[model samples]
Target: MKQSDIFRDNADNCLQLAERAEGKPAYKRYSRMADAWTALATEQDWLDGEIPPVKVRVLQMQDT
Candidate 1:
């Protein structure tokens, strides 16, 4: 299995925890953790070359 897959699995687990959380604080914390894990998975995919890197477009400002 790939590292990204493991990270995704961790994210899923965090979601589950959030679902079972007793209070708003716990739920929010777990949800944020899941987001972080998901981000890591996406970054891993980019590092592994499974997906293309995101391209940024810069716009030039016009002088008024």
Candidate 2:
């Protein structure tokens, strides 16, 4: 959330850099990514994911 907000605020800076042609190819790539990045910035308030570990229990066997 916070990082994305930071990016939002810096968007103009990105466009300006791209406009200034820091490097033609890199500028085009970054410029293209700007929209996707904007989507990511606007898509969610926070990130969520889950990864769980396995567990096992053992018991002594009784004689038959």
Candidate 3:
């Protein structure tokens, strides 16, 4: 399996944990962990060249 897939699996696990969490703090922590894992998976995909990188736009200032 690819590293991104593994990361996504981890994110899924975190979401499951969040669902079962008893307290608000625990739930929030787990949710944050899931988000981080998902971000990692997306970054891994970029590193592996699975998708194109995001394009950035620069704004030019006009002289008054």
> How much lDDT does each candidate structure score?
0.99, 0.64, 0.99
Error of 1 at 19 (Å): 0.3
User: What C-alpha lDDT, on a 0 to 100 scale, does residue 34 get in candidate 2?
Assistant: 72
- Name the runs in model 3 displaced over 4 angstroms: 60-64
Shift in Å, residue 35, candidate 1: 0.1
What is residue 46's positional error in candidate 2, in angstroms? 8.0
Rank list by TM-score: 3, 1, 2
Best by TM-score: 3
lDDT for position 14 in model 2: 67
Question: In angstroms, how far off is 25's CA in candidate 1?
Answer: 0.1
Estimate the TM-score for candidate 1.
0.87
Q: Write the per-residue lDDT of candidate 1 for residues 1-64, one digit (tens) a residue.
A: 9999999999999999999999999999999999999999999999999999889999999999
TM-score of each prediction? 0.87, 0.46, 0.89
lDDT ranking of the models:
3, 1, 2
Candidate 1 whole-model C-alpha lDDT, 0 to 1: 0.99
- Model 2, residue 22: distance off in Å is 4.6
